[model samples]
Target: MGARVTIVFAALAAIHTLTPTAQAADAFATPAVTINRADWRAAMDQLRSELNAAPEVAADFALTARRRSVAADDPRQRPALVQLNGVTSAIFTGIGRSPVPVLLPFDTTAYLAARRKGAIDPQALPRHQADFQTDLFDAGPSGYDAVFSLPTEATSGLPSRVFARPVEIQITGSVLTYDVADPAGGKGESVKALAAQYPDLRRFIREGYVRYAFTRFGVPYVVSIQCLDSAPRPRRLACREASPIAERFLKALRIAGGQPRRLPPEIAPAAIERPPAPDPDFTYRPAGDIVVNSGARGQSGRADLTAYSQIRYPLDAPAYVHSQSFGRRRASDKFDQPWSQYPWRDNFCEARSFNVGQCASGFGHQGQDIRPGACPVRRDGPEACDPWRQRVLAVRDGVVIRSTRQQAVTVQVNTGTEHIRFRYMHMNPSALDADGLLNGRSLREGQPIGVVSNYLDHPNGTTRHLHFDVQLFTRDGWIWVNPYMTLIAAYERLIGGRGHEIGTEMVSSSVAAPAITGTLPPAAGPQADAVHAPN
Candidate 1:
């Protein structure tokens, strides 16, 4: 009985196997109720009423038909319309760069009724209708090669304003006559004779009238001039005479006692009038004393003398003895030395040459060559003399925007969104632990992060050191700031001059002093001003 039931269930499942669903019959079917004659007639009536109210309906109708025809040919095309968003729509009839027609669709019944009532002439409507339908259905040529419907706001606003307020003198140009009468006839002999001499006079007259009308009467006018003659007998004289006459006419029509105003020059319309200059020294004040520092040579092992002697030296004063006396006899001697071995006893800042004893040479030491003790022969080498492996501290707190372990020699820290990037190069690969801490966690000022080694090669095959560079990005271009400023600034802030002394000792006798004996009184003179070192 169980077997029979199972077989019945399988048979039922098989009968209901997957198949394609049939499409709905109404899909793609045109509804008979669409385009109701009565509704269409009503819509047409309304459209005709609107057209009658619009003064430019004839031009608008011509433009609409042309656009509809183009749209019919290519249904994917957008209709021409003046967008309130201040953007012009696409052209359909190729009349203007913007082909979109701004006219709304006409209601057929109202349009037909208006034509029958003599409100809208059938003769005028048919020409435009035939032109539109021909282009739409038969792809036939149109009477107008190009047509454009002007913005309704631009056309209607002026007329509405004029109707609201009437002006006294209503100065107008010859172009108004052309638009009102036969456009060709308006450019008669007088216009030709005048324009032949002064070509730009007509333009000035036209613009003047437009400005005056718009400003006073709130009416907008367009000027059109036709030149009938090909050449003039006296061109120069005609222009000279016409220009003065046009100018005089404009000057005479100015509203009496209205307002004394200067018309802005067409060329530089946005120029602002400048105000008078303010008095000098109105907010001036004298600057305070400018104290300078000799810097941290005494503590950082950059100076060989006692801390007292180092601090006593005048800022910017020449070193009594060159770096050769401190151990690096030649520039080549310090090449490729580890950071631990960086002449802590000698002033690395004083060494100016890459070779021996030469100051200010082009091949001078590029960076401060520090001897970071000895290099670790093995990964697990003793750490007694070693400063700290990967114990490098950030020079300044900043975001770590980029991190790449593949480039073991350098680590880049982004200080800000500006292109200024701080580069900690020639780093010990092991110094940066799992969490990127140089030593255990934090690195103190002047504390060693890693022993600098010549394990890697430079492009020039010369000895390498920490190549610190400060760059500034400006509108003009990138500029290199002196890194010496950063070094001196950091040194002064960390040591005692501006603030209290760090220890009891005024100066240390030895480079690696375990303890200090006593403290000396602060030195006076310019050295006293060196208290806070400039960072």
Candidate 2:
């Protein structure tokens, strides 16, 4: 540690303000390639058909991060701000004694402000504490700051970070530098074997780490070794210092263990204990005039929703129909069959009892409810409780950013400002476990994310329909965007036609409509938190 430089948050903010703001024009727009939905669907179909035709192969290798410690005497010091490429990052130091570091979108101003005050407001932290950043703490003149945590010296001494959340690297040994003498010779083998063949590489991992750096979305990504339990402090290495260091590090890394099972562990099937079904007398109504909530800006105008944003359907084509439309007040008379509809339209703002002015106070139904056409009846003709039989499809090509098993699955589309989040709820728990749905997995349009089921905490909490919704990235963070028209548009594309009404069809006709309860009561029970829509 010859010289130490600590760049605090305030200085970082000042420097960032002074830096040139001009960025490549293309960065503000999505990719130039136009998406042809038909072609995309055909490609997906072909890929699936080919997969069904291919032979299954067993996984042959296990990839695991080995626990290796770097020597204590390593001299490298962690940089306050390491920005080699487009990405500018800071090391995350875990909260309290937690070994894992908290990685979040960098927000220099907040971090500096927190540091200056020698405390952090817990309420100011990102709402989605795991992976996001917001200006929730910087509401300067507003008296809404009480939502943040009590100020504490949590981030006081750390380097000025892009975010108030700290970034940290796990420590172990010194930064080991290496080079490949011959690329052709070092093909496949463990470091131990490689050390025996190339004696010069023997002391690498045991003593230090091989560092590498790159960038994505104007963000820099750096890889390096950590020197843990070091005498003076932890050490890090820069891959750019020497090309051989990177090449040799790559050659030394190899899969040594045999392949492990790819399937995730299965969870026990959650039991379905149906609550006393509601017998509310709700009137059936078709989609009425679109009421504009003047309080909410993006939703004030009346526009054809079905013709807006490009997105695919969540359910399979043709057969599935909308039981309730966005503004429809129609609901099933039977308490147990909540998803059963009256008007053959889609259901959106049925939670009107929660609050008035649909999209204004964020108190109304935020999304639409869709069902898989008919309920399968058992042999004796009772409602067939086979909720997992139907498939829930991805509405677009996006990343499965958040997959909380049965709770929900949220896919995010990241095409510049067109970025939107699609969430699917009421997935079968067992099916979700079997399919190994997890976070960070990239998904294609039409991929089967999970089976349709009523598994919200319990199997019988609600009806067996996917509660689908859309969210947009706003200054307020990810806020609910009306999905009614989005679904209408997607459904039309799926059927290659307009929304078709069953019209005295078998299911609707057979199940006689319950007597209308002239005016429905205000939504009873507890009003759910607006931050999260009710299941």
Candidate 3:
């Protein structure tokens, strides 16, 4: 908003570029606090023993994210269904290990009877595993469990981030919590009533999924039964039926994570900066600039005023911010059409595969497509580019949460009071698998994750460009948001200066963007006439 504030943000972004490889690696170098594994393990063991003494509620009540063999030796301190202490609660003290212990007041008899009434065997309910972010969690037969947002730096021991946290946190479902990706929340009488029980609870439906979010012990937890279309009547398995059960879980929820100290309130990201239109030739489209099936236009869309994360630029080399598919074909747009050149356009909500709630139409592209620095010279006396040569960097210090073989690599960053996720696409999944970028991996900010390459379902399914987006933690869990402003800020810091906003009158739809002066990276110039590789 102010020149002074812009300068401050620019300075911070500079830090990302200036020094990159420092995280837990710089532990001894700096006076930063670190936690030892022995100490962490000891603290957890103590917590487990305390719970065993308090109330050893034992029941075979179903609904869990973990697979348990009926014949396998039960790891609980007490035998299954033994009623160790009047059976007023249930303790999921993780089998085969005691890393995380959960104690909750549950009516074992009533739960069992209800399952039987519905003609379902409570004890025999299948343990439907939770899928990666691509699909929903199989919430078992009862459709509920004291789910935990695991894979966090505290819960999982990622080599780089394991020792980074000053204190460890306990999440329910223990090791099984690893499969549970984003915190999903949903609605109904059950959800509303459950929300009522917690103070400062935020409730909403994200992309048809209802959610309830609240903070406790300085960390945020979300509960969702994954229901949708709560119209004239509450959808089955929606929050209504879950209300009573959820209320019970919250009432019995213990701050078992053993968070030693309270966390401060979340600090909202900075607001959008509106610097004066510094250059007429430096044109760009505004947010929610919904492109028709076949209509290309110059500047005129209004700017969106949402705040975005100020993270590191994703690419190491220079890149052009443009659309890979603006070559809609109806206009005979060539593979190397100048349409892919500068005067960077905002394609966050462009028509593409996938759904985005941030888009005005509620469904479209979930990220911004960027082409890395100009293609290198070819051996055949021409300048052709290879996307695989460009390096893709980790935007921040975070844990890799994407499943094995999953195409999109999502890194979850849980620092301070913010829980954010950054996603990178187009890189081949097979390469990632070989590189050990699998789930629970730790990544430092600015680390070279992999080289950019075009690999959708098959090789080069789309153009050679990086489809990047940002997802913020909200009442409805993790959902996609536009990264336009964030990228602009990051680019400003990347190239060491600010970019001017060009007005509509200065642009023409019939022609591609003309080259201009600024801090923009290579390939920002007109590429309409340049011969390039096949998509």
Candidate 4:
């Protein structure tokens, strides 16, 4: 018993001795990781507070690696967001003349809305939105301003405003400005030879960008390198300067979901059937020869001098019905009429729609409205209503700037300084979705966008018809241009010898056509804007 008692006392003594050591260790040991975490949290909170306090600083935040909920963003905004998330997150490290770190540079939504507003280049606003923007001033690599190592954004709410200096940098894709080449050199071969001569081009192709340039309308363009690989490294530094930060930004990128349907093949221009009317003379016309002159209503001398015969008819059918034209006219004709009595005609400046100051005498119709076909008396008969038979075709080669599912689709031709726009309204929204006519998609001339319908705010706001109009960018902003002469020229080309009149069978896609190449001009630059395809 004494021995057991002694052992218990000794064990108690040892416990007492070890308790102080354990307590001391606990007291002296600092939680280095926990304290560091607290400090980081405080720093992040302070930084966010500072960013929120300064608009300019916050704008710059678009250049950094940060994210927020875009759940409330519009569906139209999704395509742009997907593009933004893509180009910004691609890692260009090891793809350039110099190796780069991972990066997230381009701000998709901000750039697309401002691309044509003249932020980067003052000469012409970009008519089409692209996935990336280059240094118009060419800030990187001496004499190689084309290197797109930096992501760019125009000042918020001020697209035309130029920055005092280039501030942000990025890892972006490369583009060949072949259109800028001199014509004296055999335009096509010169680009290839120039590419052969450029060392950086070699460097870009080795580790950086996919090689491409805009093919011209058979016109020779100058070749220049723009924005390739990643941002420039700091002098004296052998590797990427912003790599670590860029890596963080890359990880933060959130790619938007869903995919667009593949674009269908284009219709050969030679195969498009024409109306049965005599070919309209395309020679420069006198005002007296204008078919739909607004001057008939005492509004003369307001004609658009720049207007020419350019576009083709928007519909494809045997015959058309016209319940309305441009301007205000009280036509007692019911919405449903047989083709024999109400054949559609070329009516541009005729007296139906809203009033606009840009018209002949400050108060006239805004655009031409033509019905696809006569509606059947029965609401559920075979010929009751068939918008699909009147598929809307693009009149020119351009990018679809707006494809509002419920309202309209606007396509803009991006000529250097003479940008023009065409609008097609009253299309079936479900048909448009099925055809994949989303915003920013490219269209070939004669390409079917969708079927004509009577959709305005909902499915049946007006009778089944297509509203067409043209606009040109002038010093006074976008003004409506008469499409009379333009339609004459296009129709003559479409029909060849003499145009055919509306037949019992719709002219569009009805005539058995052999597969032939289309005559529409191909896009001249890298078509990397839509995320459906790679750059």
Per-candidate TM-scores read 0.23, 0.39, 0.53, 0.37
lDDT (tens digit, per residue) of candidate 2 on 195-255: 5423433222211222233211111122232221122211112212222322333232211
lDDT of each: 0.22, 0.34, 0.43, 0.34
Lowest-scoring 10 consecutive residues by lDDT in candidate 1? 28-37
The TM-score ranking, best first, is 3, 2, 4, 1
| Best-to-worst lDDT order | 3, 4, 2, 1
Whole-structure CA lDDT of model 2: 0.34
- Model 4 residue 405 lDDT? 38
Residue 417 error for model 2, in Å?
4.5
Highest lDDT scorer? 3
lDDT of 4 by residue, 297-399 (tens): 5544344322322566676533342324222333443434532223234334443222334444433334555555454443546544443455688988766
On TM-score, the leading prediction is 3
TM-score between candidate 1 and the true structure: 0.23
3 versus 4: better lDDT goes to = 3
Worst 10 residues of 4 by lDDT: 29-38
Q: Candidate 3: where is the Cα deviation over 4 Å?
A: 1-205, 208-220, 223-255, 260-283, 290-302, 327-337, 378-387, 510-535
